[model samples]
Target chain A: EAGVVQSPRYKIIEKKQPVAFWCNPISGHNTLYWYRQNLGQGPELLIRYENEEAVDDSQLPKDRFSAERLKGVDSTLKIQPAELGDSAVYLCASSLDLGRNTEAFFGQGTRLTVV
Target chain B: SQQGEEDPQALSIQEGENATMNCSYKTSINNLQWYRQNSGRGLVHLILIRSNEREKHSGRLRVTLDTSKKSSSLLITASRAADTASYFCATDSNTPLVFGKGTRLSVIA
Candidate 1:
């Protein structure tokens, strides 16, 4: 089976411009997550989706960052008027379901460079 | 915000040597997991140890969880050059898995 898939492996955009990243979780996976990993740092949770419902998105910057999981399979994360600090890797992951013992599968991630 | 914190931000060892990484988390967790990420690639699951379990091994990888100390350790024996990567520890408690700043391991051949 194919793993979680993410598009635009690398993206470069000017500051103040808008950029979007897309993710398609593994087939039959009910739980998906979006994470941001800055250089030299671990991935941080940006949002999480259980099917089509976004159950945890408190960490997402509402002013500039927005995400949606339409149809409960593919997810999109958007950054409007991007800032230089927004340059990082945006990762998507999925699991069979949300639980304590299950492991997550990750995508290659989209490396966004805000210049 | 991140919960788990990995010790020894970086490590360097010769091939065939053993590599050990430690992680400490704040809150209680139902399970702890270790992941490896090669440069410019995605994170891959290495192993998972449940709270009720103390030790588990997979191939050359050994994972031990200590719920009382809220810490875990990952041991990779007979490391190879291919083992060079960033290792991260994650915790789950019915919530989205939270990761720690990873420990970069360099296994020189």
Candidate 2:
């Protein structure tokens, strides 16, 4: 099977500009996740989706970040009015199920650079 | 705040040497997973050890999870330069996986 796929491997935008990243999870996977990784740091979970519904998004920056998985297969993460601090890698991952033991598959993240 | 913390911010070793990294978490976790990230790329899942599993071996990789100490260790024997990457430990909570600051390992051939 194909691995998870993401679009626009790299993105650059000015401060206050808007940017978006897309991800297509593995086939038949029921769980998707978006994460942010600052330079030299581990990824931080931004949101998680079980099917089309977001099961966890408490860490998402509500003021400018929004995500959706309308069809439960692909997901999009958006950042509006991007800030300098927003420069980081945006990663998307998926797992077969939301159970405690399933392994997640990741895509080659979108590296967002805000100037 | 992150639930897991990995030791040795960076490590460099010659190829064929054994590499070991440690991780400690704050809360109880259902399972612990290890991931590898190449430069300028996304993460790849390496291994997962449930809280109930004490040790597991896959090829040259060995993982040990100590629930009582809230810690885990990953050992790669006879490592090769291809194994150079950032290694991260993640905690599987009820929600998403909580990750720790990774250990950057460089294997010199």
Largest lDDT belongs to which candidate?
1
Pairs that collide in candidate 1 are: none
Pull out the clashing pairs in model 2: none
C-alpha lDDT (0 to 100) for residue B51 of candidate 1? 91
Evaluate model 2: give its lDDT.
Answer: 0.92
lDDT of each: 0.94, 0.92
For model 1, state the Cα shift of residue A25 in Å: 0.6
Runs with alpha carbons beyond 4 Å of true place in candidate 1: none
Mind giving the per-residue lDDT tens digits that candidate 1 earns over B47-102?
A: 98999999999999999999999999999999999999999999997465899999
Please tell me the interface RMSD, in Å, for model 1.
0.9
Backbone clashes (count) for model 2: 0
